[model samples]
Target chain A: MQTLHNGKLTRSVSLEDRGWSLGEALFETLLVQQGNPVWLEEHLARLARGCERLQFDFPERALRDDIHQLLSESRDDRAVLRLCLSGDSLGVRGYGAVSRTPHRYCQLAALAPPVRQYWDEGIRAFVAKTRLPEQVELAGIKHSNRLPHVLARAERKARDFPEGLMLSASGLVVEGIASNCFIAVNGELKTPLLDRAGVEGIVRQKVIEVLRTQGVTISEARLTLSDIEAADELFFCNSLIGLWPARQLDCLSFSSFSLCQRVQKELESVWYV
Target chain B: MQTLHNGKLTRSVSLEDRGWSLGEALFETLLVQQGNPVWLEEHLARLARGCERLQFDFPERALRDDIHQLLSESRDDRAVLRLCLSGDSLGVRGYGAVSRTPHRYCQLAALAPPVRQYWDEGIRAFVAKTRLPEQVELAGIKHSNRLPHVLARAERKARDFPEGLMLSASGLVVEGIASNCFIAVNGELKTPLLDRAGVEGIVRQKVIEVLRTQGVTISEARLTLSDIEAADELFFCNSLIGLWPARQLDCLSFSSFSLCQRVQKELESVWYV
Candidate 1:
C-alpha cells in the first residue's frame, strides 16, 4: 500500500509519532472511481470542519495536491482513499503555552469487496448493547476517538451480523457501526439527528440532500428501534458502499425496498456518479 | 528522550505501527523518586485490566523487565515514566477480518513541575463545557481515547485556570482534565464514582484507601456542581500531583487547607515514601 504523509509519499509511519497513542486524529474516506474521488469537496469540507472543531487549521490546498499525487501514482482504477489528519500535543508542556497543530496522511488501497450483495439481497443488522454519549464537543466531527465503533463492530461480528446499530444514552438509535442510517416511516424518509451523537457522514448528507431536492420529504430526528420496525423500508450508507438495505434487524424484516431502491438510484445516478 | 518499544530501547518508531490512529492503546505514568517508581504494581494492574477490557493480552513480565532496565539506564533521581501500549488493527481487512494486537512503548521524561503552590496557596478550577460520555464499555479503562482531555486542557488554558472539571452527560461531576476530584461535604469526603464515567486513577484509588484506613470517611457518589458548591472544602488528586486543594471553582471559594494538608502528608509518608 502507498501512503502519503505531510505531502511526502511513503510506505510506512513511525509508531512513536504521537498520533497512534494519543488518538489526536481525524480522517475522511472517499470512494475513488476512474481516478477521481467522488464528493471530494464534501469530504474536504467535513475535514476542515473537524479541524476547526479540534482548533487546528487545515491546509486544504496542500492536501488537495497530496491527494491528486497519490491518486496519480496509484495503479488501481478504483479504490478507497483514506486521508488521516493527526495532531501533536507538543504545546501541552503546561497550561498557557500549548500548540495543537495537525499533519495529514493519505493511504490508497483496493476497494472493499462490494456489499452490493447487501444492497441487493438485503442484510442483517441489530441494535448494539453499547451506547453513544451525547458530546456536543465531538458530535458530528470524525475525530479519531472511535472506541464505540470498534466495540460495536465487535458486537456485530459476535452476533454473526454484518452491521450493528448504535443508540444514544437515552435509547435513541444513532447510527450503524460504520454507516449512517435512514428509515422510511409513515411515507417520510428519516435519519438520526447528529447534533448530539453520531458522525455526519458525507454520503449520508448527500443522500438527504438529493432526496429532498427530488421532492422527497426527509427528516433528521431522534429515532428508536421501534421506529425502525415501523418503517416501510430501511437502508445504510457510507462513501464506499453507496447504500445497503437491511432485510432483518432483530425480529423485524422488510421485503419491500421500493423507497430504498429509489434513494439508492438517486445516490448513484445523480450525486455519486 | 529515550523510548523502549516492546522491551527494546529505541530512540524512535515508525508510523506504520498501528497504535497511532486507531486509539487502540493504553498507558500508565509512574513517578520515579529515588530510583523507585511509586505504586508500580497498581499501575501495572490497571494496564492489565485495560488490556483485558480491550481484548488484548498484556505482557506484564516483559514490561516489568523493560521498566527496570530503563530505570537502570536513567540518570535522573526524580522523573516521570510513561508506558504506552498501542494495539494494531492489522486484521481489519476491509470489514470482516481485522486483528488487533498491541505493542508497548516506554518514554522517560523529567518530572513535571510540582503543583505544590496549588497545595500551599490553592488553585482555581472550573466545570468544562465538554462532557464525558457514559460509556460502560470504556468507563474506567485508561485506553488512549484522550481527545476529550486534550480539548479540556485547552479549554482550561484559554480560561486561564490551572485545571478544568469534567462532568458526565447527565450533569454529574466526573473528574478534572487530568485528575480525580474530591470534595468535603458535611465533613465527609466525596468523589465521583467511575462505574459509569471517568478514569479510575491509581492515586485516586490509593487516596480512597488511605483515607478510609485512617478513618476519614470517603464516599464515591454521583455529584453535581451544586453538590460541589455546597461543600465546605474541595480538592483534586492524581498520581503526578498527589493532591492539590482548590481555592475556587467558578464563584465558590475556601481558605481552609487543614484536611488537604493532613491527606497530603499521609499520602507522601505512607504510600509514596
Candidate 2:
C-alpha cells in the first residue's frame, strides 16, 4: 500500500511484483508544469477508477506524497511524472496476489521536445496493423496491459511516422498509438467510444468539456475507417500532447483544423507552463 | 538479450522496466522436479517465439544461466521456476524502447501442495464473467498482458470455484483461467482453437502429442458452451498441474474421465518427478 512514510523512497521494485508479471496494475502519466503536477485531481481520480477495475485499492495519500516528493527534488520546470500502483511484493504462486496490499511508485522524467510543433503543423499518421480487441471490463481505464500500444508505436517508428490510428478486428477505428483521436465530419465532432476498447484519455475528456461549453456538438461513437476518411478535419489528444491535428493519414490529407486549433488554444495553460 | 554473465545476479528489478509499467514482457513457468526443470527446451523455445512477436531478441544463454543459478540455490526438490524476460530499464517516453536490450529474471517458489489430488478427484469450474478479447497478434503466447486471466481467477475465487472457463466476445469457449481445456464427446477429444485468443498451453500440447500417438482423435476447433455441455468428459491441463479432469462445471456434471486417466498415465514422468 502507499503507506505514509517519513523515510526515503526506494527506487527499485520487487522482482515478484505482479505489475511486472501480469500487468496487474494501473498507471497515470501526468504533466508537471513548473514544479506542479497539472490536473492532479483528474489524474488521481482516473487512477482510482482504474484501480477499482483492477481490484486494487487506491493509495491516494501515498501517491500524492510521492508526486510531491518527486517534484520537490526535480529541477526541470516542465517534466513528465508517471505513477504506477501495483500489487505489493509477496511470495508468488500463480496469478493470485498473496497479499491484497499494493506497491506505489512515482518516477519523473524530462518532457519530450515542444509539443506545440505537432499542434500547429499537425503530424502524419497511419492505420496501425495492430488491432484493439474489445474487452468491455478493461475498457476506458489506463491500466498497464499496453502491449498493443507498444506494437503500434513500434510499427509507427518502423514506418517512420510519428503516430498511427488503431482499429478493431472488425475495421472500426478506435484510437491512436498513444493518444485518443477525434474527427470532424459534416461539421460534427466525433471521437471513438471507448466503452468497448481504448483508453478514455484525460485530455480528450477536457477537450470535449471545453468544446461542448463553446457550443460545439461532440459525441462518442463507434467510428470506422470510412468515417475518418471522409472527415473534414482530424486531431489527436493526450495529457502530454494537448492537441495534435492530423495533416495526413496514409495517402489522405487534411488542410483544415479549426476545432483542433480552438481546443489547443483553450488548453494551453493546462498542458504547458 | 540473454547475454552470458559470469558474475552474481541482481535480485531487484528496475522500476522503469516496461514489464512493470506496460506489461511488455514474456514469461515462462517451468516445473522443476528434483533439481531439474521439466520441459526446459520447450519452454525456452516458446519464450523465443514470444520474443519474436514482441520485437525483442531472446536472451537464450542468459536465461539458461539464470535457471541454473536459481535451481542450484533452491532447497525444494519440486519447485516452480518463473523466467521473466522484460525490456531493459530506459528513459521513459511513449511506448518505444530506447535500447533494444531486455532484462531476464528467474525466481523459484515452492510448488503448491501435491497436484495429484486435483488430477485424481478432479475439480469444479464455472464459466467466468470476464471475456478474453480476440487478440490474434497476442494469441497463443505467454506474454505478460494477462489482466483478463487475473480477473477470471479473481472471479473464480469470489464464486468459490476451483477454476473458470474463459470465452471470447462471441461466446466461444477459449480456455481455462490458468490452463487449457479439452473435452471428449462421442469418442472425439477436442480442444478450443487458439487462433483468435487464449494461450497454446505447454501441457495441452503434450497431452495432444501423447493422445494422438495412442490413436485417440483430438481436434482443435471453435468450441461453444453447448459443445462442452454435451461432452462426455472434460479436463484441464498446464505445465505445473499436468492433468486435472473437471467433475463438474457450474450445474453440469460429467460421469467419466477415462481418456483423461489414459493421458495422465502416459505423461506421468513428464509432470511428476
Q: Which candidate's lDDT is highest?
A: 2
Stretches of candidate 2 above 4 Å error?
A: A1-7, B1-7
Per-prediction DockQ comes to 0.56, 0.73
- Alpha-carbon runs more than 4 Å astray in model 1: A11-18, A91-97, A269-273, B11-18, B91-97, B269-273
Best by TM-score: 2
DockQ of candidate 2 against the true complex: 0.73
Model 1 chain B weakest lDDT span, ten residues long: B91-100
> Candidate 2 lDDT, tens digit per residue, B1-273?
121122246656766578987889888888888889988998988888898988888878877777787777778877887787788647556788776667777777787645576889998888999999898899898899989988888775733566788999878999998889999988879999998998888888888898899999989999999999999998988888888899999999998998999998988777665
Q: Residue A213 error for model 1, in Å? A: 3.0
Q: Candidate 2: lDDT of B258?
A: 89
Pairs of colliding residues, candidate 2: B2-B59
User: For every candidate, how close is chain A to the native chain A in TM-score?
Assistant: 0.92, 0.93
Candidate 2 yields a Cα-based lDDT of 0.82
